[model samples]
Target: MNLETDLGGIKLADPVVMASGTFGYGFGYEGLIGPGDVGAIITKATTREPWAGNPPPRIAETPCGMLNAIGLENPGVEVFLSEYLPRLRKSGAVVIVNIAGRTFEEYVELASMIGTAKGVRGIELNISCPNVDMGGMQLGTSPDMVYKIVDSVKQVTHLPVMPKLSPNVTDIVEIAKAAESAGADAISMINTVQGMAVDIETKRPILGNVFGGLSGPAIKPIALRMVYQVYQAVDVPILGGGGIMSAKDAIEFLLVGAKAVSVGTGTFINPRLAMEIKAGIEDYMARHGHTGLHEIIGAAIL
Candidate 1:
């Protein structure tokens, strides 16, 4: 419906947003999407320093989703703040820079950098980055670690903070509450679930990284469920991601309590997805006689 929505202190023109990692720097899809068409543009998950990322052949397709181990490749914070933000300043987009780190100190440092950055509206703490040593899913599975990392970032940044949750956890609600208590302004879920695909002939994992996060339509149901449960557990805003593509899919997230929903692999399939979903959501809202998107949060019946 009238998907004009607000999360935390960030005002969104519509509830449709571009997920991190999928949308590179704002300029990558410049000609494809109008800068003002969607709610926000979440840049690639950035670390404190530049990363070359995992080896090639880092993606594999599942029945309905895709597995990826991009290793959070980014041009480091300095380059992003100096070069990228200057270019994105003209895009008229609400830039929410997603920050990730291997340690609490790194998290605080990244948040400090963003707190002083000029062109960004908010910060997203990416606590779900699979650890290279802990087998990837360790950090996301614990409630205490979730709280500690969120607190570290929150203490350093004045900007609204949103923690991206991992769906690989046994209890997402517990982690969501920890984030809220740690002073996160909002929460976004679920990050890709850990998955692996095997090459029959090679008898080895298809992704060069061996294990990766699964995304696309196949993860929608699980994402929706996590959003619903997390929404029930906390009062802070929730931005749902993972496999949302169309307006109807976006609405499903809204109905499940997502203040906004982000498009990831969906954009890979169609660059114009943000515009299409923006118009489609508005039209759907008007037809349904909805004056605002807030009314739809948690509208789903068992």
Candidate 2:
């Protein structure tokens, strides 16, 4: 089966990609899976400077998902380029750097820096990080800000820019269109839905940040709906995910029009989930007599 696909100008060997943050710079599970196992690897959300992140109790489990307020903790871009980039390049997987910034200038700075970095294939602008105060979902909630950030980042980087959209919005389609109009090459949909959990015994919140983003099976239905809606609203390709635990879920995103599907929280449950999902997709294609991914992408639209 032809699992190869494209996200804007960046071509992939397959449509299965590891979601940012969950995979931790793409080298954490090298012992379990190979670089060629998936289409590409998106590094954790990095900022202009090193981040301390949130306090303890940053993660809490829910009914079918989990809430995390990890606060975008990272070693900063300089350390990433000097250390992580070299290791990532050596792995031989296509590298898409996911970056977050406190301001428009910071976002542009990050793009400009990564644009020239060796072995970097694309940039996933993380405008939807709900854990931090300065950046994250704060900048993603406004359509105007989304347009400006994407536009500014585009001005500096020749790499494909994908602005991850937040589901916590009045209208996700409007935000998606803003990114498209601002020159985003592609878009990543359904960044974790904003949620929180409280401790009835203590009569207090469970997370260190009080509120956190929810991910896993609980958000899959809502994520699918957003991806389908954004597909019709924008012409750009989409990287879709949220509660995608298996190949069936990934296929659902593809039928709804996602050119690629990101495997996030699912990895926590199964470190080899990306490879498993990829194999399952190929198996399904063979069973259905489909030769290429395009044959099924958006096949449900009619």
lDDT of all the models against the reference? Answer: 0.85, 0.91
**Candidate 1 weakest ten by summed lDDT:** 130-139
Candidate 2 regions with alpha-carbon error over 4 angstroms: 129-137
The residue-by-residue lDDT of candidate 2 on 1-302, one tens digit each, is 78889999989999999999898987657588777888999999988899999987999999999999999999999999999999989989899999998778888998999999999999999987442544344889989889999999998989999999989998999999999999999999878988999999999999989989999999999999998999999999999999999999999999999999999999999999999999999999999999999999998875
Give a tens-digit lDDT track for model 1, residues 26-76: 675657786687789888987889988999798998999999999888889
Best by TM-score: 2
Clashing pairs in 2: none
Candidate 2 vs. true structure, TM-score: 0.97
